[model samples]
Structure formats: C-alpha cells, structure tokens
Target: MDTRERLIESTRELLWERGYVGVSPKAIQQRADAGQGSMYHHFASKEALAAEAIGRSAEQLRAAAETQLSGPGTAVERIGAYLRREREVLRGCPIGRLTQDPEVMAIPALRAPVEQTLAWIRSRLARVLAEGREQGEFSSRLDPDATAAMIIATLQGGYVLARAAGTTEPFDQAVTGTLALIDANVAE
Candidate 1:
C-alpha cells in the first residue's frame, strides 16, 4: 500500500492495541515502515493521523450498524441481530475505547467522531424501540431513549468486563441478559 494508507492503517491498529496515550508517532512510522519525512508529509502530526484513522473506523462501524437497522424484520429482531453481530469482544469497540482515553477526550476534534459514532448507534437503537412500540411489538410502558441508553451501556460495559476478565463469556452473558430483558418486554 501507499505511504498514506499504510500510515493510517498502522495508526488504526496501534490505536486499537495501545490506545492514544500508549501509541507514538515513531511507533506508527515503524509499524508502517515509513520514514519520519514520509509520515510528516502525509500528516501534520500523530494526533492528526489518529484523528483520520478514528474517523474511518467510526464511519465503518456506522455503516455496519445501518445494515442491521435497515434490515427487514421487527424492531426487536433487527436490534437483536445487531447486538448479536459478530465482534471481537476482547479487543473492545474501537470507538468506545476512545471514550476512555484522556488524550482523545481532551481534544474536541479527536472526540467528535467517537461521540458522534456512539450517539448515532444509540439513536438508531432508540428509533427501533420506538418503532416496536408503534407496532405493539413492545409494551406501552417501554421508554425508548432510556432503554436505548441501557442497551448501549450494557454493550459498552460488557466489553470492559470481558477485557478485564480476558474472555468473551462476560460479553456473551451481557448480551444474553439484555436480550432476555427485551424479550420480557415484548408484547405476547
């Protein structure tokens, strides 16, 4: 691949592995096998390169989520499809992980993509819940926004628990529990 693409890909991988504080420009250059001058020519600095990489990851995630959200099915079915979507639970959500990075949170430009990505996912899920209510697929008492937040929080927190436990079981358990709750709320 070209130097620019190589650099961005390297940054993305490193960001996923080491996070913002743990990754450095030299490390990215080495990983990409590109020299300092080449990297600098393409990116003003490491932060700028990371920003671009994060943006790409965010866009990719949004697109993947849209596939499930727009699919033919009841709202709960589509949401279940999304929550059960194959994921590297141990590696964690790239966008969600950024929320824990001090450097990322300190910079608005760097944080925007991450925030927007999660917000979009949550909003999409909320819309699905609303649709389910309209169709009487869900109980009338269900609160879409609150339930959406809980669902997203559970997913994000599941990643944290799984990463700490060094296994995917915690993540699976969390998804199962969440699905059970949704099922309980579904209209018979």
Candidate 2:
C-alpha cells in the first residue's frame, strides 16, 4: 500500500487497540512501516491523521448499519438483524470505545466524527421505529425517539458488559432481551 494509505490503516488499528493517548507518531510510523519523513509528508500531525482515520471508521460503521436498516424486513426484524449481525464482541465498538478515552472526548476534531456517527445511527433508528409505529407494527405507546436511544444505549452497553466479563454471554443476553422486549410490544 502507499505510504498515506498504510499510515491511515495503521493508525486505525492502533486506535482500536490503544486509545488516542496511547498512540504516538513514532509508534504509528513503526506500525505502518513508514519513516518519520513519510508520515509528516502525508499528515500535519498525529491528531490530524487520527481525525481522518476515525472519520473513515465512522463512515464504515454507518454503512454497515445502513445495510441492516435498509434490508427487506419489518422494523423489528431489521433491528434484530443489526443486533445479531456478527461482530468482534470482545473487542468492543470502535467508536463507542473511543468515547471513554479522555483525549478523544476532550478534542472537538477527534470527537466530531464519533458524535455525528452516533447521532446518525440514533436518527436513522428513530426513523425506522417511527415507520413501525405508523404501520401499527409497534404499539402506539412506544416512543420512537426514546426507543431508539434505548437501543443505542443497550447495544453499546452490552459491549462494555461483555468486555468487562471477558465473555460474550452478556452481549448475547442483552440482544436477546432487547429483541424480546421489542417483540413483546408488537401490535395485535
């Protein structure tokens, strides 16, 4: 791969494996197999490179979610598909994990993509829930905005539970329970 591409990819992995504070230009260059001059040539600073990489990761996350949300199925089924979609559970949500990092949370440039990506997810999921409500697939009592926010929280929280326990059972249980709650609310 080209130096620029290599640098970005390396940073992405490093960011996932280690938080923003843990990453350094020298470490990135070593991981990318690029020299200092090459690294500097493509990016002005480590934060700039990280911003590009985080943005790319956020876009990928959105695209992956879009696939499930847009797929042919009822709203619950689409959401269930998203929740059940295979993931590296133990590794945790890339963007969500970043939120726990002080550096990422403190910097606007670092945080914007994470914030926008999550907001996009919540908005899109809300749209689906609203559609379901309109079609009478969901109970009239269900609030789309609240339900969407709960789903986001549950999914991300599941990752934290699973990672903390060093087992996937917590994540699986969360998904199943969330789905059961959704299914229980189905309109007669």
78-145: candidate 1 lDDT, tens digit per residue: 99999999998999998999999999999988999999999999999999999999999999988999
Each prediction's whole-model lDDT (CA): 0.94, 0.94
Q: On a 0 to 1 TM-score scale, where does candidate 1 land against the true structure?
A: 0.97
Cα deviation at 76, candidate 1, in Å, is 1.3
The residue pairs found clashing in candidate 1 are none
User: Over the full model, what C-alpha lDDT does candidate 1 score relative to the true structure?
Assistant: 0.94
Q: Assess the local accuracy of residue 12 in candidate 2 as a C-alpha lDDT between 0 and 100.
A: 91
Shift of residue 41 alpha carbon in model 1, Å: 0.8
* Residue pairs with clashing backbones, model 2: none
User: Model 2: what TM-score?
Assistant: 0.98
Which candidate tops TM-score?
2
For candidate 1, what's the RMSD?
Answer: 0.9
